[model samples]
Target chain A: MADTATASATGGSEPAIGRGLKGLLLVALPVFLVGWLIIYPIIAAIVSTLFVEATDGVQFSTASYRFFFSDPYSRANLALTLWTTGVCAVLLLLVGLPIALYLRFSTSRFADLVQSLAIFPMFVPSIILSYALIRTIGPNGTVDILLNAVGLPKIPSPYLTPWGPVIGLVWDNLPLTVLMLTAGLAGISNSAVEAARDVGAGPIRVFWHIILPRMGNSILVTISFTVLGIFSSFTLPYVLGPASPEMMGPFMLRTFNDLYDPLNAKTQAVISFVFCLFFGIFYVWSIARNQRSQSR
Target chain B: MNRREFLAAGSAVAAASALPSLALADDKTIQVYSGSDNNIIDFWNNTIIPAFQKANPGMKVKLVDAGDDNGLRAIADRALAALKSKADPQADVFENFDARLPAGGVEAGLWVTFSAENVPSYGKINRAAIDMPQQLPYRGSQVLLAYDKTKLDPKDAPKTWEQLVAWVKKNPGQFIYNRPDKGGSGGNFVRRAIHEVNGRDPSKFTIANFSADYAEKSLTPAWAVLKDMAPFLYEKGAYTSGNTQSIQLLSQGVVTMVPVWSDQVLQAMSQGVLPETTGLVQLTDLALCGGFSRLTVFSNGANKDAALKLADFLLTSEMQSAVITQIGGFPGVTWDNVAADLREKYKDVVPNSIPTFPGGDWNAAINDGWYRNVATGLARG
Candidate 1:
């Protein structure tokens, strides 16, 4: 408080720097609480998952890692997570591209409304969306009601299956994906687009040759954000997901709490952190690298 | 005053308003911690608290449903830390038990012995209910077999472990139960099964030595049965959702029957987690394990005596029954058989009795048998 007061007395960029620090603290306070409650415990679980004994002060080993993924249940779960991510990402690109473009060119009020709706998922927290999806698709839930209306079999929720988590992941990541794509599309120079149209180029040709080339940097931004969102999401998948092929969050929990094995949990946490760290670094780096090269 | 100070002061005031007047009372409100559900907490608050408080007017039972067993365990850790500070703990009582009980909690003065004389209907509780200061619930949960009669039909279902395994072989994935290390309910099943199957003793926990590995090897028979039962699981040998899963599967018609909390089965029926055909069974040679989810009052509780009084009230007969009705809180203390009229609504659909876990074998079961076998060490296979 005294330092901030001193900075304000200086009444220049020093005050601005102090305000920035205050803003940083405002952000950091919640992050610390969230980290303690949701993040660190999860990290503890990962550490626990790496070692076999899970006993306190035990050294790290790959035994748990070997055992967990060696079995049919764990093995099947890994495949499920990978395949689901791949399929969902492709599906997102296909479905999200049109929505992104529609919002880019049209200046109509309806177009703006559509754009808002497209990105609404970003504002809607994943936890709320995940629950709503589960309730809707759960066995004997609303989906079944619709199925019955269409004279279909009473297909129960695949909630206990891997696909259940997939829907949650896509729903959570989609809004942000669309948001990034829209930003990229909107960033294309209007003058260049107008010149192309004035020179008798068709709209489709213009979009493919000029607008797309110009917006390459934005598209990369969308990919980077989407990948980051998918990699880091903990809640939507953990709750909606099945016990088999348990993700990093659930596995970490089992190690530290149920197993009472912190060493292994810490190892697991470190490994997960490493995985996310590398993936994020590569993603961000690629976006920056692309932006730099494109400026040429 | 500055806004943050004002808010912090307001917090203290709110805390003060919520505090019970303890100055003139021998017994006062006991603050409780649990991982149990809100519905369960509400059940304790409305039905259990009033009954105990009515008898001991000075007592008001305050339950803070922290989360689940995990949340309760964390609260226990915090209280233990506060005990070190030689100060009053934020939490008065917490509910949980695991490998940490003997080594971590009980030995740590996080627990003190609870008595029946101080508790209402303590004498009526079976000897098996008092195994350790830790396992005994002020309220006990019974580990009994719940079978879906529609699946087994006219054959009168399995009456013994041998019969049950045979049934599982005939109808794969028709029967299921939880793994022990996952939670206490399953751990109870493992212990009960060991006592019934191999005649192990709970009081004799030591095996040539106190090494956990020794305990692990001692559980061969129980694991052998589980190994055979494994192939017949609902997911065909996948890890189950523990006790709760079996009840849900019974409701979904996925598995015919499995072991679960007797109260959970009843709650399942109430919540529609179990189908009507599903009912509980206590075998003639039946063995069942029981554990307490007690209101464990920490020594450094803010109001220690008041907490003790609240704990005492919760253990009373009237409060136990109230816990039974709403929280489906199982009664550790013996009560008059619930009204025959009430039984008729759930009796045939539920078990006639909670299978008694062998009193003679808890030590062997928990240490080498249940703990070693299912929890820490899997059978060599």
Candidate 2:
């Protein structure tokens, strides 16, 4: 492995100009594809929202944006979305980081079982997960029946509340966070950990100084992804969240489909994309930093 | 050649290449886009379309079901988008429930207008159904009370709006209707309550021109009554989100009663999702809101004449009766024309006429208002 790495390193030192042109050639196709597929639709959506159609003709107008911002429900929905996404991302870090750490360091059979369990949700579609959560936690559902069987009072199902999405989002985001963290931990050197332990540093101290610094980019990626996923999510929050303080996903859908307000829906979608960029910037920054480090 | 001549040559080549496919598409085949239930689609494809094709030799009809994911609303959204862009729509006929597509298609000039002169079946259709502009009524559905008979005796069931309130008060958590924005049955239930609470007259709410001021003034009593009734709903102040959800609750005995579409309940009963003892009630005091799903011919379509012929064929007695027997829907034509057995079965619950769904803007306002004033008001109170 060392010989192969050395050979590749030596080979990689070829003249910068040729390598740079080759690199650009390889990336050009992907950049063009991304621009066409992702950037074009985004530009179209923004442009569509900027124009207003009247009896005479289409003209430049902020009518859609004004309509969306003017509605109290839209403002409430935005806040609720931020709250749900923020809380879920934080909770996932608190819960998932420890699990990832344990899975990374331990080799026990229980750790292997835990690893399998953590990734089990990756196979389950969000819609199926939503329904499963409903059937398990809904009124007169499995949990209710179990509680009744044990002669216990049935607590109202949380599946219809804000906690519902929190639970679902945490579960949904777990696999990806764990996978990223585990991969990140693999890159972390064992010599540093051993040295820290040899020097009599405690577990928390080692984690704080040695592990946390190494996992910075991974942590950012996980948190940013979790926030983005929850913010733009539709099926889970729509099925789980309360109707009045709806998240932007279901709210925008209802506005466009049921209320027949396409313009407002498009405006709301643009607003959501703008909000996502707040977290999305971290992802962009992480990628740029990684690219810069690699180039160096 | 110059750049202009070269570009013209390229354009000519592209157009020539596209000629065969375009010709194939305009080969007199009528395309119908429907988001109707599977059973209705089966009846149309198996019985109606084949018969219509045979009657009109050298003509073809194609039925496109939107499947489970893309429903009537999705189809309407796509069609409307195409119409707004002034492009030819893919389908000739657009069929779906009134609430899902609404009569707004007619008002927007998206549908072809029909009268007795153009459509012979119009003479057989009920006069009340005929006057709906640009709408061709093909099947009827009414919002009705569906109850588990094992839990409540049919004789003891609520027969009027007042009786329903009293019964609900007596037995709380035993009934539920979906949120109005979520399902047509629930929306109609709210609309009916609004009409019944103030007065028994349907005329009061059936204004030709919708006035928001008049609605606010007249519907004050309705809001009060709905607010009062909300607490007694199943799961205390909580409610289901859709017609299927409420029906599932009923089937599970989670709730003994729910407001559901009559035809939907029938279909569910046949499928065993609902028990044998389930029964339906149409209140006498407040008329159950009822309307027919329309088979609309798109104004900008490839085959207009064939589409019109297919629409006419759908309204005939044979197809209308098939709608009842196969799909559990009321006939679009005069009630007397329906099969005797099916008519007798649905006699008690059959509505006298199709109720008008308020104009699109009015509907949007009312649905939003109810969500704010009634649905949330109950929760807070």
Clashing pairs in 2: none
Can you write out model 1's per-residue Cα lDDT over B1-381, one digit (the tens) per residue?
Answer: 788998999999988875744442344457777677566666766776677677776657677777676676666676777677775556666654442443466677776566654444446554544545534355656666787777677366776766766877888857656655554556676666666555544544422344556545655666777655665765455444356544555665666777777667777777766667766775445556555554555666766666666665555556665656665545655545344444455443334344434322234344324323332222111
lDDT of 2 by residue, A1-296 (tens): 99778869888756789899989988999999999998998898899999777788989999878877787667877877888888888888888889989998998899989999999999999988987887787767888889999999987777456777778888888899889888888878889999999999999999999999988888898888778888999888876656557788988888876677878888999999998888899899997887788699
TM-score of chain B of 1: 0.73
Off by over 4 Å in 2: A1-72, A108-116, A199-206, A289-296, B1-23, B26-28, B50-59, B67-90, B97-110, B206-208, B377-381
Highest DockQ model number: 2
Q: Model 1: what TM-score? A: 0.72
Error of 1 at A266 (Å): 0.6
Chain A TM-score (model 2) = 0.86
Chain B vs. true chain B: TM-score per candidate: 0.73, 0.85
Residue B123's lDDT within candidate 1 is: 61
